[model samples]
Target: MKIFQSTTHYNYDWEHVSTANWQKYSPWNEKTPHVIAVDTLSRHVDPASGVLRTERLITCEQNCPKWLTAILGGDSKSQVYECSYVDPKSKTLTLCSHNMTYADLLSVRETVVYTPSAHNPESNTQFTQTAKITAFCGGWQKIKNKIEQFTVDRFVENAAKGREGFEMVLERAREVFAQERERMEMSQRA
Candidate 1:
């Protein structure tokens, strides 16, 4: 098994960052071209905690090596099951996801969290992400190690791109919100 962890800070408020999370895969985010589609399976708000819970199915096209594709039965597309929790009271967003495709041969579980930065809670958000990779091919220790390492490397590279894509979305969302605020102010003045 291989474990990967990362921490990043976004120069945006937690509320904006959290809202942008949902638009990470928007068409405007060119950095996430691998993401083909995202579908919401379920969503509900917890009355007691005022937390929103959501389930989603994500489909991604992977650029895997020919050898890897052959080993995995020639499938280049991957599906992931993701669940997210948005706690309004705590001002935190958490996402957990696992690969559904090729689960028998390899497993990848990932978790991400977004919260207000301690240094500047009102203007910055802290992002933390972790992933575990494991290969289940029996009696092939060398191959398993190679698979795990490859996955870890890919995850790290993708993590950077994901952050870039999300940043773009956040910037756009902030612009839209600013425009809306200006409109409201003008209307009120009128």
Candidate 2:
């Protein structure tokens, strides 16, 4: 079992980042090699906290590290997960997830939190993703380095793509809010 922690900061408020995570659809038509598709199985909202929970089959393209692919028994299928997006309050939001399909051969539980920056609270969001991995097989040490390096690479790639998608969503949200505000102001003047 291995645990890895990574943190990424975004130059936006927590709400903006959280909203993007929930609603943003990337420009996936451009062909995302690592992520092929996302299929939602079931979802519900927590009335009390307003957290959105979902079960999904995430079709990851066959781009895994060679060693990891070998570990997956050379199967050609996607991974499924049960995930949740926590409600936003003040300046923070959290996303939690657990893997379902690979529970025996592998296990993963991750928590990603988005928080506002202290220095510029209104202008920045801090994203921290912590992932725990467990491999239920022997001979793991032989390919430990490959596993670690691949994990790091994926972390970076995901962050880059996530940032792009989040920014587009946040910008669109701002534009819509601005338009609404202007409309309300004009009506008041009339």
Candidate 3:
């Protein structure tokens, strides 16, 4: 009787295992393994003091509850940072925030409408509409610039009122103008 010997082979590279595994486990990979897109600005949690704090973008969809809705104000659907805070004791939630740009401020206009009908076919349909105006940051930089220009113009006009020579008034105006500009700049930087 003739017997044939069987061979089993296993491919294992112990030396290169670490390098090969690194890419599979790397956190910086371009594609997230399991990611669900969520509106970051729509998550909120209540504090101990009964006040609601709108959570920042760091909180991802995985951590937040699925019931939250993302509503961006105005005609455009661009998302901004904000959330509706629902109180356990009450049916309403108060909105709050700061540091708004001009575009941000303009987005506060919102309109909502609801329509309900009755069983009677000939009756007119009932409708409800509500409008709200929210406060937003008014692009403080632009306002500050306008104020500074007005201040300088007023100073120059006042200084020229009773001046003897054009050059002397101009020199004094420059000195005052420089001082005012420095003060404003310092305040802004602070």
Candidate 4:
């Protein structure tokens, strides 16, 4: 078993960062070539708490080590089940995801949270992520450790790329918003 944890800050506010989360897999994020598709399984707002809950299935191209792929089979894609909660009142977003493919041999579970940064609450957002990797291979401690470590390393690399991609998306979103606001102002003046 292995655990990976990371924390970072986004220059954008919580609202914009939260909005960008939904567009993370959009075409703007070319850094995530592995991600192929995302399907929303369900979505609804909780009447009591006024929180939004969503479930999705994400599909990605398999990019495993040759030896690992040999053991897992010839499949070329992997799937993940993700659930998210958005508390608008609290300005927090939390996402939990688990690997749905090859669970018998290995498992990866990840949780991510986005919230207003303490240092700059109004203009900055904090991002926190944690992942647990476990190998279920029987009587093979060496293989298990190797798999977990490899996964951890890969995850770290991918996390950085994901951030870069999201940043690009956010920048594009901001530009569009600015243009729209300018147009609205012009129309109002007219």
Q: What RMSD does each model have against the real structure?
A: 1.3, 4.0, 33.9, 1.4
Model 3 stretches with alpha carbons more than 4 Å out: 1-37, 41-44, 55-77, 94-106, 111-190
For residues 11-58, what per-residue lDDT tens digits would candidate 1 score against the true structure?
Answer: 999989988888889986889888999999999999999999999999
The local lDDT score (0 to 100) that residue 126 gets in candidate 3 is 23
Compose the digit string of candidate 2's lDDT tens values, residues 22-56.
55544522324555667787888778876666666
Model 3 C-alpha lDDT per residue in residues 1-190, reported as the tens digit of each score: 1111111111212212112211321233323222233233545464575634443221112222223223442221233233334343432233232212233433322221111224321322222222232323356766545544543443344223312132233334446557989999999999
CA error at residue 8 for candidate 3, angstroms: 74
Mark the regions of model 2 whose C-alpha exceeds 4 Å error after superposition: 28-36, 45-55, 64-77, 100-103, 176-190
TM-score of each: 0.95, 0.68, 0.21, 0.94
Task: Give the runs in model 1 whose Cα sits over 4 Å from its true position.
Answer: none
Which 10-residue span in candidate 3 carries the lowest summed lDDT?
1-10
How does each model score on lDDT? 0.92, 0.65, 0.32, 0.92
**Residue 98 alpha-carbon offset, candidate 1, angstroms:** 0.5
**Deviation from native of the Cα of residue 180 in model 2, angstroms:** 5.3
